[model samples]
Structure formats: structure tokens, C-alpha cells
Target chain A: MLVRVKSRYRPVAMTAAEAMDGRVRRRERNAALLYDAAAELLATRSLDEISVEEICRRAGVGRATFFRIFETKEGLLREFNRRLTADAAARIDAAGDIDLRAALGHVRDAIIEAWGHAGPGHASMALTYAYHAPERIHDPHPELYALVRQRIERAMASGEIPGVVPASLAASLAVINLTAPVAWTLSHRADELDELSGVLLDQWYAGMISTPKPDRRRNGPRP
Target chain B: MLVRVKSRYRPVAMTAAEAMDGRVRRRERNAALLYDAAAELLATRSLDEISVEEICRRAGVGRATFFRIFETKEGLLREFNRRLTADAAARIDAAGDIDLRAALGHVRDAIIEAWGHAGPGHASMALTYAYHAPERIHDPHPELYALVRQRIERAMASGEIPGVVPASLAASLAVINLTAPVAWTLSHRADELDELSGVLLDQWYAGMISTPKPDRRRNGPRP
Candidate 1:
């Protein structure tokens, strides 16, 4: 009788813990659904026009559950920004010892792939968040800046790129150069994003380099 | 008595015409004041938060007068956009046959100065219009695109830049590359906007040129 009582209590305790874990997983999944639904709506319509009830209906969650997960639409957007930055940081970290140009290409491909994976609706919302809410993307992600800086430093050490350009400016320029094509593609509904990106990357790679000799005729005399 | 009557009638007719001309001038002046006031407000505030009453108050015009000029806030923004693109087109037209790089620098300086002249408040609103309402700026101004294409073609002809980059892509890339830094500076309130822009431009110029030889060790074998 004593053995049975001890075993029974252990199983009950384990089941309780398991049930709590399962509930957490379910809550997280529901929150993701709500965010995804909100992104879809935001891509097509203005934020002021979207109602919580509509988002709940699309997400297939109860209104109460939506409120439980996100306090407001802005809060939901904040969470999305957080996740996007985290994903970008992870991708940057995963790029092991890649040269600056190739690493830039990798980052660009990863972002383009992410947009494709998110579908057109969510991708559209992502672009707005990127441009309109740059602080959210840049502030909490010093690692991102550091990653770009490190790549530039590595390139500089190897003499692959010029040493005169400031690392910070180079980092900013790299990001700007990569993202501009993506924004254009999304806004224009153009299918040539990858090709456009290739052209940009090639130009960027050649542009940052030093020529062995300066052509005086082409450059003209120095003032 | 007949001579005196004719002289009096001539002065009365002249006075009536002068009064009509003065009224037209006043109307034009009031509309300009209202547009300027709205632009200042929009620079510092989002579109939705600003009221027409506040704009009228700023412009020292009556609400009725404001409505007489612009049917709605959107109408005001549309006018601002039209004028902004027109100003840019005029500036581009005035470049003549200047060298490509110097012309580019001149254009960049002119744009930067215009932003400064607009003041920080109006400049912010202008950036939003440039990106969000591109149709208003670009559609009516093929001259803007033509200006960029002209520069690229000129540069290619002089062998100042690489010929491999398509003129269209080069034009789009140059505009995107230039504008991204401006948008960043405005958003971050960064003090080194000009310095940052110079570095970007220098990097862009160097990157676009043809390299005599690729260092096999650095580039590795092409896949």
C-alpha cells in the first residue's frame, strides 16, 4: 500500500508539470497566429482600420486570448520587431568566417528568403516596420552592428577593401545598399529582386576597392 | 463738363481692374502661406494627428479660406509633392553639360541644402512623401529618372565608371544609395549627415570602377 501511494503521487506531479509545459507551448503558438494575422491585415490595410475582433477571427483565437497575449496592436508589432531582429542576429552569427562580400550576399539572401517564407502580406508589413520603426530594429541589436563592423575589419586586414573608409560608415552603407533593392522589389511587385541584388552587390564589391594606379586623365588634376 | 466726365470714368475703370489684380495676388499668397504652414506641422507630426484648424491657425488664415484653397489635408500634401518634384526637375535641368562626378556632387549638395532650407520639420514630412507617395513625385517627373540616366550615361562615356552596370540599374541604385543615408540621418537626428554622405559617395565611386586584376588568393576560385 505504501509503495503504491508514493508511485501514484510521483505520476500526478509529473502529469501536472507536463500539462503546464503543454499549456505554455499552446499559448506561444496562439500568440504567433495572432501576430501572423495582424501582419497580414497590416500589409493590406492601415492599422487604425483593423479591429481586435477581426484579428482574433482570422487567427482563430478567442478575443480574450488575443488580449491575454498582446495588450494592443502596437505591442504586437513590437513583438514582431523583436523576433525579426533576433532572427537577423542569429543569421549573422551563423555565418562562420565568410568574407565581407560573401557574408553580405548571405545576409541578403537570408532576408530575401525570410520575406518569401513570410508570404507577401507579412513581408509588406516587415518593410514598414523596418523603415518606419528603425529604432526598434537598431537599438536592441548592437550585435548586428558589431557583426557588420567585424566583417569590415576582417576585409580591411586582408586588403580586400580600402582601409580609408570608416568601419561604421561601411557597415551602414552595406546595409543600405542591400536593403534598397529589397524595398524596391516589394513596393514595385517586381520579380527581379535577386538579380537586382546581384547587380548591387557587384557594384558595391568593386566600388569599395582601391585601384592599383590612378588614371589622371579620367580623374583630372587634383585641386 | 463732358471732358471732366470722361476723365472721371477712365480713373474709375482703371481702379476696378487694379482691385481685381490685387485680389488675385492676395489669394495666391494665402494659399502659399497655408501650404507652408501645413508642411511645417507635417514635418513634426504624423498625418493623422494634425488638424486643418491648427494649420489655418498657423497660417493666420480663416478655416473657410483654408478649405477654399485645399479641399482636404491630402490635397495640401498633393500640392506640396507637386511643387517639390517640380523644384527638383528644375534643378536637374540647370546642370547643363557638367562632368559626371562633379555634377553628381553638385546635385547632392543642392539636395542637402534644400533639405536644410526646408528646415528640419518640413524636411521630415518631405521624406515621407518621397517614399510613400512616389507616384506623385516620380510619375509626373520622368525628368528625374532621365537626369539619373543621363549622369550614368555620361560617366560611362567618359570611362569614369564601369560599363557593365546597366544604365537603368545604375540610375536606380544611385538614387536609392543616396537617399538611404539622408533618411537615416533624418531619423537618427545624426549630426554627421554630410560626412556620412561623402564616405558613401566615395565608396560608391570606387566600387563602380573596373579593377585591372582580381587577386586570386582573396577572391578564391569562382564556383
Candidate 2:
């Protein structure tokens, strides 16, 4: 009984924190490499036609590595969207307590910058993907949706905006207003952005708040 | 010598009215046949997966005949859309001088009815095609777009609405609003046709006339 039994030799299990941290770093690096390649390939061809091999070659990663990170081409596309959406969300979240006009302008400017830097082909691909990927677009990382929704709800609660409209609908409309201009720009009608954004903002604020602007009469002779 | 031409051998072009009528009748017949076949086949397969041969076989038409009528599968799909859009346009146009709310309600009712009559599978296929089609949802049909734009512009002119939001944006939004709800419905969501239609009408009117409603306050409140 005094003698200790010899234990079998075994590898020690990694701590949960260590495992998670390593996994997270690996995922982030792989995703960055994939996106860099995707952005480059997208610049030359439409998304529908771009093959996984091309992306892998461009990223200087093997097929196995690519597959280890992304399940499919669409998965890679979603990753790219996730990053951009997160960036935009961060910017929007940072500008807390701003006026509606200024806040919306900030959102609009961020969206424009994102779209502009996305380059023409990548922008078109992202738009086309968004159009076809309804489920993805609606829930492309629900955390972002939740954050945006909470911010909008908080704004509504502040009475800076007046609306009985459901928070979800208002969020959806804000999204539509922000993205619709990009859809037009993707079609090469870039000149329409300023005018379209103005119209959209006016409609959103005036319609939602039911605020009567005295200048309405100035737009035309009262109909 | 030319006077010796036989009456039976001479080719005769139909008059403009007669030709147009005949063309319409032919189109109607072909569409009915194709629609029936498509509805039946779509129960088990997608439009992309279905072949021209299969569509023709199901329709009891020859491959050549199918091609003669529809240049491609996309063309056939477009024809189906054209029928639906035309029907919607006719209904909307008939409700002349109706307020934006009523007119939109009528259009919604018509669309719901049309969708109701379609088999669930066919409705799904149509939605998929509409989403993926090259043309943005409403623009492919100039006639429909023009009619919708005119109605929006008229609504704005009526001073019942107060802003200069482009008629085009209003028209596009109207189409998207109507389509989005129905598209959502197809997925078996917590949506009733009448309720969704009502929300859409409310949003459209609010957006169009810059009318502030209680719901607008529910959007993010200004800090």
C-alpha cells in the first residue's frame, strides 16, 4: 500500500484558455490571408466565376489549408463581409449620442468609404452576393445585427426619433437606406449617391418622426 | 407574268391589330402551357436544375418549340415574371386616383392572390429566379417601372406627400417592400399577408409624404 503504482505515460491536456487563444489566432491569420487573396482575385473577375483554387493560389496557401479555414467559396465571401460589417459597426458604435442627421451622415460616409475602397469588382461581387445570400445578409453575424438593433432602439428610446415602428423594421430601413445607394453605385451610376442619400435621409427622418418641415412648401407650390 | 400568282400561294401579313391580337393569344396559350408544366415540375426540382427538355416534355411541347417560344430558360422565367408584373401593373393602374395607401393595398392584394394561386414550389422557384435575375427586380419592365414611378410622382404632387424624394426611389422601395414581405411569407415566417401589407403601406405612405407617425418614434431615439 505504501508503494505508489506507476502511472501510464500520457500527454497533458491543454488548458481551455490556451486552446481557445491558439485557435483564435490561427483562425484570424487564416481569414486575413484568404481575404487578401479574395480581394485581389475579385478585382479581376466576377465572384461567380472565381474558383477556390485561384483564391488559394493567390493567398499562397495550399488547398488543404484553405479548406481548413473556409468550407466553401461562399464561406470565404461571408468572412469578408463579416469583417467589413464589424468595422462599420465599430465606427457607428463609437459615435454614440450623436444627432440623427450627424449620426446618419456618419453611417453614410462609412458605407461610402467601405464601398469605395472595396474596388469596383469586389464591390459588385459583394453586392451580388448580398442579393443572392438573403439568409446570410439578414444574419451575417447576428451579433452585429443585435448591436445595431440595440443602438437604434436606444436612439428611438431617446425620443430623438419618434416611431412606433418596430425596432426591427426601422433597423431594416436604415440598412436599406445605407445600402441602396451602394447598389446604384455598383451599377456605375456613382453620381447619384449624394442626391439619393439626401432624399433617403429626408424620407427616413421626416416620415418616421412625422415632423412637419415648414420648408416642404418651398419644394414646390404645395403640390 | 406577275399577275399569274395564285391566291393560295401568296403570303399575307396580318394587319397590325390582327397581328397584335394573334400574338397576344399565342403568348397567352404558350404561357399557360409553360406555367402549368413549370408548376408541376417545380414541386420536385429547381429552375436551374431543370432542363429545357424536361420542361418541354412536361409541357407536351417539342424542344424546338420551347426554344422557339423562349430563347433560354432565363427567357422563360422572364416571361413568367412579365405576366405577373403585367397583371400587378394592370390592377394598380385600374385603381386610378386612389391614394398611395389604397393603390399599394390593391397591388398587394393582387400579388397575394396571384401568389396564393401558385403552388408553393412554383412560388419558391419564382422567388429564387426573381432574386437572381440580371435586372434589378422592377427595372427590366420599363412599362411597369414607368407606371409605378408615375403613381409615386403623382402621389408626391398631390401634396398628400411633402418631399422631393426621387420618384424612382419611392417606386423601387414600394416594389421591395411588397416583395420582401411576400418573400418572407414563402419561408413560413410569422407574417400574415394583410398585416405585412398594412405595415408596407404604412411605411410607404410615411416615406412618401414625409408623414410622421407614432411608430417613427420607436426608431433609435436621438440622444
Candidate 3:
């Protein structure tokens, strides 16, 4: 669990636990400052236009400090994305012992709320991730995938989503279909970003992916 | 109908009809030469590394002539994509009032065959199209969508795939899912490009794109 921080640093000597706590708080505060600065800068300018020095200066943090927190500028966006997924994962976990459909509703609602605030910064982040390393279908955003995998496994145990298809593909399929709008916003339909993700997510939750291992033969044996 | 040309031009004076024929032939030849040269160079070099002058030089065509033939290098790619869609559309049309699933099988086979020979040129072409202008979910690959729309209408006419969903959405869904591999080739799973498209297409063929309206209420009124 991340301990949210309030202040940057204190020079006075203290107990080892107190010192570690101060370090954690300072680290988190710096990360939060850098993220806010990046978002503010990216609101009016493209990623290429914003320099690291500007972000550091705006955050009131040293350049070396910024580097210590994030390996690259994109690391900030990735960390933010990780938080969003973690939030949704927690919700999915909280839905324990409930129906699968209701659990997926949490996933859909999480996306809707997230994209509601998405600006050019978010769009650029998504594009960078896509171009640098496309999400692997087998495993992507591992923690969230792991949680969703467990959910699917439970569904399969109950035979809700058809136990025939492997739980792995089902989870990946569900995750990718649900998350497609992030990458899609970089396209011409960007204007429809907020609305489209909602629609796609709704459609996904409404019906399961075609999991029935229907006559795969008539398709002529996978070319 | 496209008149495939064998050679560039012959300047001998001829009748008006012959002159028109020569112009069409020369125009097509120029476009083909540029496409082939672009593909050959792209095989070894990234798109950013190659220049228009180099492409023209390799094609033995002048820069002015290249510009006349293609609005932009990306335009050449768009045309190639157009050709691929045209070929698929032709096959779909020739299916001529056949069963819907069987016709869809023709669409799947067409994608598999095309991707088998896809190279970096095809991958770059897909990315350019994806970034510049996304295919509208309402209408994509116009010629192919039109034909598939008609086919879906015919199926609905016979109540085959069920007439609940609009033929327009169904056709668009089919086209987008079918062509997903072209854009997907840019991802890390690119090695599976040829194989994955085959599977997705088969899944699509085996089942419809969730045409059933199903209980949308349980998903919480679309966020």
C-alpha cells in the first residue's frame, strides 16, 4: 500500500522508522508534483514541446530528484495508469462473492470516469505506450490482468461465461476490449473518445466474447 | 475497371483514343513503379530513413512524375489498401446470394491469404491509415462495406443472422474485425500477425458480433 505524503523532507535526526516514513512521504510528494506539472504543461502543449527542465522547475523539484522518481517522462503516465488500474482492481476485489456481471460493471464504470478527464496528455501517453511496446495479449498490466483472471476463473467455475475457453484468453479479451478506447483516441474518432469508450464497454459487459468453441472446422483449419 | 499497364509511355502520335489509352497506362505504370520501389526500400529501411528522391530514383521515375501519380507516399499505401479491399469485395460479390456464413468465410480466407505475404511496407501502411484517419465504425472500406451490407441485408431478409441488429452496424463490425490484423501487425505480437487474424476472423465467422440486443439494463444504463 502507498502511504500518501504531505511534505517533502525534514533534516532533523529521528528514529529509523520515522526516517523511512519521511523518505516515503517525500518521494510520493515529488512524484505527485511532477505528475501535476506534466499534466498542466501538456494541457496546452504537445509532449515534444514540454522540456524536462520545465517540468522539474514547475514541480519545484531538482532534475536529479525527478530522475530518481521516474526513469523517463513517460514513466509518470505509466505510473498514473497503474494507479487507475489498481483502483479498478480494488473495486473488482471488493465485489467479491457478488455476480460476475456486477463486477464487470465496476470495470466499465472505472473506464468511463477515467476517460472523462482525459486530456491531450493522456492521449499522448497512450500513443507512446502503443508505439513503444504494444500491449501483449497474453499478459498486459499484469496486476489487473491477474485480478481479472481470477474473476474469469470463478466465472468458469460456475459455468457463467462458458468454461470451454481458457480463462487466460477470456481475461485478456475482456481487458483489451474494455481498454481499446485508450489507444483508439489517437485516431480520427478522437472527438468521440469519451462517448465511444462507454459504448464499447457497455457492449462488452452486455454480451460475453464469443467463447463457444463452435465449429472451428468450417473456417478451414486456421489457414 | 482498372486497366493494368505494362509500360510507362510511347510518344508516337496516334488517334485520340490511343492517346487516352497511353495516358492511363502511363499513369498506372508510374503508380505501380513507385509502390514497388517504396516496398523494396522499406524492406531494408524504416520509413523515416527513406526519402522521396530516393524512392523516385529507385523506381527510375522523376520526382515530378511521382508527385503527379501519388498525392503523398502515404497515399500510395492508401491505394494499395484500396486494392486489397477491392479484391475482397469482388470475391464477396461473386459469392452472389450465397449463405451468409459461407460468404463471410470468403472474407476470412481473403485476409489470411493477403497477410501471408505482408511485409514492413504493409505494416507501415496500416499505421499511417490508423493514425491519419480511422475507419469509421459506421462505414469503412466503402466498397467492401457496401457489399457486406447488402449481404447482411440479404441474410436479414431470410432471417438468418437474425434481423434485430441494423445491417449497417453488423457490416461495419464485420469489416473492422476482419481488417484488425493489418493494424495489429504493428504490435509486439506482430510475429503472430498472419496467424492471429485468421483466428479472429474465424471466431467472427463462427459467431456474429453480438447482434442480439440482450439485457442492456444490467450494465447500468451506459455509465
Model 1 off-target regions past 4 Å? A1-29, A32-61, A68-87, A118-223, B1-29, B33-62, B68-87, B98-107, B118-223
* CA RMSD per model (angstroms): 20.9, 19.8, 18.9
**lDDT string, candidate 3, B29-127, tens digits:** 887788778877776565666789999999999999988877776665555444443444456566665432233233333333343344555545545
Q: Count the backbone clashes (under 3 Å) in each candidate.
A: 3, 19, 0
- What's the best-to-worst order under lDDT? 3, 1, 2
> TM-score for model 1?
0.37
At residue B188, give the lDDT of candidate 1: 56
Candidate 3 versus the native: TM-score? 0.41
lDDT of 2 by residue, B1-223 (tens): 0011111211235566787777666655665576567657766666767888887787777777677766777554454434543454455566664432233233333333444344434544544543332234442233334444555565566555554555566666654554344334333434343344345445555566553332322111221
Could you tell me every candidate's TM-score relative to the true structure? Answer: 0.37, 0.43, 0.41
Best by lDDT: 3
Clash pairs, candidate 1, are: A206-B207, A207-B206, A207-B207
**Residue B43 displacement in candidate 1 (angstroms):** 14
Tens-digit per-residue lDDT, A76-189, candidate 3: 655554454444455556666433223323433333334335556555654555322223332223444454566567666765555544455545554454334433543333
lDDT of 2 by residue, A21-132 (tens): 7766666666677777777777667777888888888777778877877776656545543443344344545776443223323322333334435444564564454333
Best-performing candidate as measured by TM-score: 2
